[model samples]
Target: MSLLFCEVISAQQSLPKIHKDEVDFVNPLIGTAITGFAKGLDGGGTMPCVNVPFAMTNFVAQTGESKMGRMCYQYEDKAVIGLLATHQPTVWMGDYGYVSIMPQTGSLRVLPKERRLTYDHKDEIAKPYYYSVKLKADAKTSIKAEIAGANTCGMFRFTFPAAEKAHLIIQGINLNPELTDWANDYKSRLKRLKGYVHIDTVNNEITGYNPDRQSAQLGPELKNFKGYFIIKFDKQIRKYGTWDNKIIKKGSEEQFGTRMGAFISFKTLANTQIKVAVATSFISLDQARSNLKKEIPDWDFEKIVKDTRNNWQQQLKVAQVNGVTNEQKTIFYTALFHTLLFPRQFSEYGRYYSAFDDKIHNGESYNDYSLWDTFRALHPLLILTQPERINGMVKSLLQMYQEGGWMPMWPNPTYTNIMISTHADAVVADAYVKGFRGYSTKLAYDAMHKDAFEAPDGDMQKKWGDRDLWTSYEARGGLTYYHKLGFVPVDKVRESVSRTIEYGIDDYCVAQVAKSLGKTEDYNELMKWSANYKNVYNPATGFMAPKNVNGQWSAKPDSGFTEGTKWTYTFGAMQDIPGMISLMGGEKPFADKLKHNFNDGHYRADNEPGHHYIYLFNYCGMPWKAQELVRQHTGWQNFRNAPIGINGNDDCGQTSAWYIFSTMGFYPVTPASGLYSIGAPQFPYIALNLQNGNKLVIKAIDLSAQNKYVKEVRFDGQLIKNHIISHEQISHGGTLEFKMTSVPQKD
Candidate 1:
């Protein structure tokens, strides 16, 4: 190694570090650039608003147009309109809510169908705690924003020359799962808002005039809006228009021009700001105030913004990386930021309404359960860094069982009836194995058993398990087809591979949970379920190849893995890699084959399968190989712009989080599993301040291009020969020393 490399490695041996809270590393624009097979920008609905992750008052409207891409927004004819509380599945999948306060200017009207407003993408600005956009108009009006926890506040400082009329309009445009007719008693639902609002004075006032504003029924044309929530304003800072007195929910006869601010009359020295605050579950006005007070307790907007950014920075610090290019850092960390954005905690002030029971309860509430997507990687990352939150999440899930009457695989408040497999079983199992507390293993195991014994919807598919559980229509038609024939049919193709992998992962979680609970019989039974992977793996092709009912592999090579080929699923042996090694014949061949797979670019580093597998080498006695792979991968995966820069779908942040962990020289490959498999370190040194008030210090000795492999290893202060580190050791928090060398240590 060169002198500089020696210097870096030497420094690594004696490096100092600090906790995540000490760092200032919040950057929300990381994965904002859209890339991969998915379309649309990499924009995200998550904001560095407040608290830890879910404590923000409200997230701004990520996009107003609905173009059906990563961040696509749908617009009516021309009007820039309302916010849905739901934003879709990141920038990859088209699903999400736009919550509270839609602002528009000029001729306000229902936006035309999915006509994405053309804005200068260059003018868009997103920061750790703020966002700004210049709308696509004749004279693009500029909009800037900040948020408290659940309430979003914006400053649309419009600039205008002498104009016939300059207008500002506020209208509630449409809702997803679109509403039909305005219930006369709609106020009952609207009245749910009552929370504390901490402001300078008591008068960060809300004016609810125009209650009877005229509605324009646009037929079944619009997706969901019984009647529009239209409010007209005539503040001294800007011109205002009267609410149209026409109530028509049938067709689009309303003129678009008259809808935007009636007209605009400009004054030269003109500037003004509007504060829009909205709460979703408006039970009473007091609840709204409480929500506001909890989120924004002070008048210092800048302080709140700074605090929010600082929150993101703290989480970003949990795992740090170096040596990669700046763009790589931006993309990796930004994507990490997005992964934690949603399933936001809708509960306010330690109390939240449970969708399961339809009753108000108390606890640290969290939502936006992207269980289907996040179960793969995001939750696993959380287990390593934010394990404390695991208990509360478990409790909340238990509460879901109490209220909703079953363990939810893809749980939200109202419904738990979606997705293919029981992955929460995996999440809970992973948590238990990692040694999380607060809830009982027995209870959790019971919930898991209930879920699996029951059908997809938590009801026993047969007479209380007297017979085999009837798989849900989707599962039966899809999974059973695979079980019978070994290959998924073509018609049920959208999520074929995902379904297969998920089934295996979920069953493995079930087995793990059972084992953890000491229910050996159940564990043995579930272990068989874990063997579900065999149903799909086609050894003839040396891949997790698809098969049909009669046990014939798909003639096509790309049948089993989702969004990837057989090369990816070849590593789907997450549940039992030792068995996989045995099947592959031995550690040497398995290691060699894996190196070849990744070297031939068989590894989908940007995809979900691309995650957590490098560390598999450690289990096979090839830690050096795992380290080299990690070092090589982190060195090259650099995309710095918005969505366009990231590899594959951000999957929230799992993909990037994988890179982050791998570069740090270790990863929690299997969720809820306490062991962190070591990988190669890119940084000279890194550290993590464990929640238990200790530190995880990793020093790469003699680490460099020429000295990347470990010649020796030590734990605490004792020398060791293997790569695996126990959860107990990590939790106790001490130095982990890796003495590096060019060649593997002498056996």
Candidate 2:
């Protein structure tokens, strides 16, 4: 080896060093850019937002009109429209109750196109709790905008040149009179989403409300659902006006209707700084004002930044990260930051407006449950990093069941019922199995059990698109057929093959919960129902193939899946891998099939369906294959420290969750099973500080690119033969040591 290679190897063999100030390693911009797929690299589908962990609202620089399938801020975008307070969970989810604020100089520009201010990436700073940029309003005028975010409020500091017509525009998303389309495209700006605005010149404030949610068409008509915002300024408003579309009524104090907005104009000295704090609420206008007064009591932008940063520091510090290069550290912590941004806290000040019941109630609540995507890995990660909040999250789900009459598949505040099957069962079951309680297990089991047998409103022979009109709760799309025929029929259901397999996985989770509650009959029946996955398996193709209502396999065996293909779902029945392996002919054949799938470029690490596919090798006894693949994924290839880092939609943190788990050397391949599949640890040493005063340390001796596979695994100094560890072992705390070697440990 050359001298450089020798030095690198020596460094990798050195003792792992403890890393501090991990918050500084977070790069919010990692998944913000949409790039790389065409160039044979990972593409991203996430926005760079400034917010606290699980914050109700996210504050971000708005580049253009963005929501569900579009990013608000793209790295390629050359201008900034405004600073938006958004509740968009992911690129695949719609934003609800959103608004924006912008600083303007000279003539006022209120519309998104007119208000566009140019900015360069080099002049910007983006972090979880903070964002700042210098926007050129004119050739000679550059407005410096800095932002700090809290759970429900956002603080802004805008520095301006000596301009007499300096203005602050408070705007509402114009999406009320929306087009009845998936894109949420508005036909005309003249007749847009109805909004309300009030300019309090005496108090130097502006208040507004927007009652538009793009996901509303998929849920109950919420009577009192709207975002109420209270903006407090630390300066006097000399002149003010409200605007509706292109009609700018000067000196107007209040306005309510299409495309509503209010602007306050005043003279400013050279380099004069104006600070504004804004808080939002779903309860009422009074609550919005209260949130503003309570969360941000004064105009201390720096203090808020410092406190929020410190809050993030504590959260990021929970994992005592070590080993790897600084680049890996950035990717690691940034993924952590992404994972904690969803299942957002919807409750405000101990009270919340329930979108399901369409009323305000006193209790803890969390919205945007993205259960289908998150239950796979995100919630599993939360069980470790956010143990204290688990009860509240479960209670929130119970509240949804109580109020809505059913447990939603994907609760975007209410039920979008977006994804297939009921993975919410997996989340609840996994939590309970991992020793979490407080919510009634009886009710939890009932809710999950109901989904296994109970059919939805439209029953079967219905093409329930991913996001259809919310006419009724779609608990289990083809449950009627799956319950009777042991499989969902392709002729009856749109995504028959995928649903059959996923429903099987969900049923297995419900069975575990039932077994824990001592309901043997229910356990046996659910367990039997869980094996319904066999009905869809085509031994001829060695794939989970679609079958027609006539009990015959479809000609196109690979069709009818959700966001994936046959190669993705064939081994996706993670709940009963032994059964899957048996069906696939045997252990050797199963392992060969897995290798075939990976070698053929059919395994998509970019999506959730194939997320657990990487761990299937452990079952068939080729864990070194899993170890190698895990390293390639957790390393720089899939998870990058750049704008186009992640291969696809972070899916509200599932992508990041996979990285954290796989890198830490364990993955909850089958949630609710209470067992984590072992993968190769990229980090030499990782200290996980559990909430219950337990410290789990993961050590990888001599881990490097060269030492790529695990020679042997030991937990608490005992050798692990099966390449698996239980939740109890991890939660109770102990050391998990993996001896590394350059050669694959096929044995």
Candidate 3:
């Protein structure tokens, strides 16, 4: 048995029992504050979104006024433009399919800036499924608005001060006009960039269409891209009209032009409430109405909010941890909340509109993949907590391949071709290996194999193939020389080192699936190719350097690496850590280098490449070092309830997943490997409710901020001789106890 896990006395003491609801810790504002790194951008850019788990659409208050301001609802901003139904995954990528609505008591303004109202943040209420704010449009009028939504439908209730011309305006904003040539040519842009709004004064409703002109990137597969919506109001409409180009034409039922929208005015007494229900569909206007009817048949604002909260509570109940501070619980649950937001449900009812085929398909379809970011930790966390959801996600990816002829790289309601490498390979393989096989494994393997072996071609290449079918290998830009040179030459690609390392991990994933399917030749070949990351290692500089096509390292070696530095890529060889340590001259030397990297601030916790580096200490036979590093990084980089709490973009919850795993005292360094590298638990106890009708409990005795080192570890009373635990052991369910101390435990 390893001396690190030698038998030690367990401390016995009765601790305070913390219930699930007692925490009330899912603060949407925890990561909302802007930070230094994300300054002027979405600093700590987490959306204070109000939606159900995996809902197709989310409602957030739009506060910023600039073009880049669309990315964040800065807490410091004093004005509220309106509320929007947005599909904004991160501030960096911007938003799509956006529809804005504002309530006013006096004269109506067509533009967002003119109609913006000042609101106090202290009076605002934000919850998982509900958001409310009191906005003052002028000196005499104040509008209290509350919102809630489920699936493809949402509702808004507004209390208006008694006024003669109380009105509600609905507008569609052109989020991405750069995709069209209209930006350069004003006349052509105005003529081509058009939307439609039709008002029904008799039915007190408004219907419109917003076409996504950014289809140049979706290729021939996307026949048409449009979002249709139907909004019904509860109050009687005294007057209605349409607006175009900042001109309001009263009593006009229809309008078609750039910057088009509709408004409905009503006369109401003091404290009179107005309710609005809206449904959106990519299929047609009729489908949008049907969605509104099915999801929310009546004007019950409170019921929707209550139901949405219950829905979030049910999902949040999967893992319950006790004996943590209120602030710690807040951070943990908020991180978990962000992880469940993406890979959103794009399909409504039994029908889904595919950007790949430009046809409405009958089934559940999910979009907003962000695979390069989510595949690392988010998908793996879902595999453990929400296996059934993972099954659906796998099926969704395979369906995309069947429709588009290639798997998605980073899908935002369509094949975006954003980021690098086909990481859908890793997500699918990880699910299959973790025993979630509701999807077709054979079909998945075929997709993964095609992405790995096939050359860049029409609508199938790595980047921008979705938009331009004729995009060349050089234009696609990610390890294009992999087949010929066995490694991505820095001279040939932009992010050459990042491409090689990420591709190596993707290759390892495909090998796992191939081996499971009994393809011995392919498995062995891929396994060999997976080790190609070592080719980029430069022992001279002790960093992963870029090499030329002729196999010669760069003279100065570009310091401005891909999204990171050369030091970040040095530990990118995650598949072969033992070999990586050997290349650095053995365990002791590797440990010393890692220490210098962390102590000297070379190990970045802000990006994805170095996410698994802190856990690499486990592979070097120094579990104690891994424990302290986890604690230090978690403390420094993460926060409890501040807006700028997170150091970087959530990356669709990958950053949060690191926190969830590290706080739980283990992390999956190699996600699909099914092994979790052990660390020190932050809490005294954590109970995860498994889907298999079992509970996995973790207990840490004498656990405190100072006592971050693990003195001894045991699983269900048996000593854990190794610094690792398997998925089978955790999922089967049992107690894992840890003894902690201020001093490190020597092996």
Best by lDDT: 2
Look at candidate 1 and tell me the lDDT of residue 494.
Answer: 37
In model 3, what is the error at residue 270, expressed in angstroms?
2.1
Query: Which residue ranges in model 2 land beyond 4 Å of their true spot?
Result: 1-20, 39-42, 176-182, 185-193
Tens digits of lDDT, candidate 2, 1-747? 222223335555653467358898899999887665446543566777887889998999988766556667888799998898988887667788888889999998788788889999999999888899999978987999999998999998999999878998888756533333564544433343578888887777888888877666666767678899888888888788988878898999999876668898888888999998888999988988888777788888988888889889988888977645566678889999988888999999899999888989998999888888899999999999989899988888888888888877877678886889888888899999999898998889878878876888878647676777667878888888888899988887888888989998898998988888899999999999889999998887788999998899998777789988888888888899999999989999999989989998888888889999888898998998998888777655577778878877788899899989998999999889999999888778899999769999999997765887999899999999998899989999999999999999876
Q: What tens-digit string does per-residue lDDT give for candidate 1 at 1-747?
A: 333344344554434465333223345544444434344323232322223454323444445433223243311123334333333434322322222344443443333232223455465555545655555544534433333332322222233333343333333222222222331122322332111111111242322211111111100011221111111122332332323223322212122211121221233322344444343332234554555455555445556567666776777677656443334345556656665665555555667756455567777666546565566567766766777777877776767767667655443333423444666777777777777877876788877786554433322222111112123222222544444444344333434554555666666677776776677987776666556666665555556665543455557657544556767777775777787787777888888878888888677666666576788888787777776677666653433344344555556565666666766677776655567776666656667767767778888876676877777778888876567777778778888888877886535
| Model 2 Cα shift for residue 31 (angstroms) | 0.4
Q: Which predicted model would earn the best TM-score?
A: 2
> Which of candidates 2 and 3 is the stronger one according to lDDT?
2
Q: Write the per-residue lDDT of candidate 3 for residues 576-658, one digit (tens) a residue.
A: 78888999999998988888888897776777778888888888878889988877777734555677778777877888988
Candidate 2 lDDT trough over 10 residues, lowest sum: 1-10
Each model's TM-score?
0.75, 0.96, 0.92
Answer with 1 or 3, whichever has the higher TM-score: 3
Each candidate's clash count = 97, 1, 3
Q: After superposition, how far is residue 4 of candidate 2 from its true place, in Å?
A: 15
Q: List the candidates ranked by TM-score, beginning with the highest.
A: 2, 3, 1
Question: Which 10 residues in a row give candidate 1 its minimum summed lDDT?
Answer: 211-220
What ranges in model 3 sit over 4 Å off? 1-23, 37-42, 65-72, 175-193, 213-221, 458-480
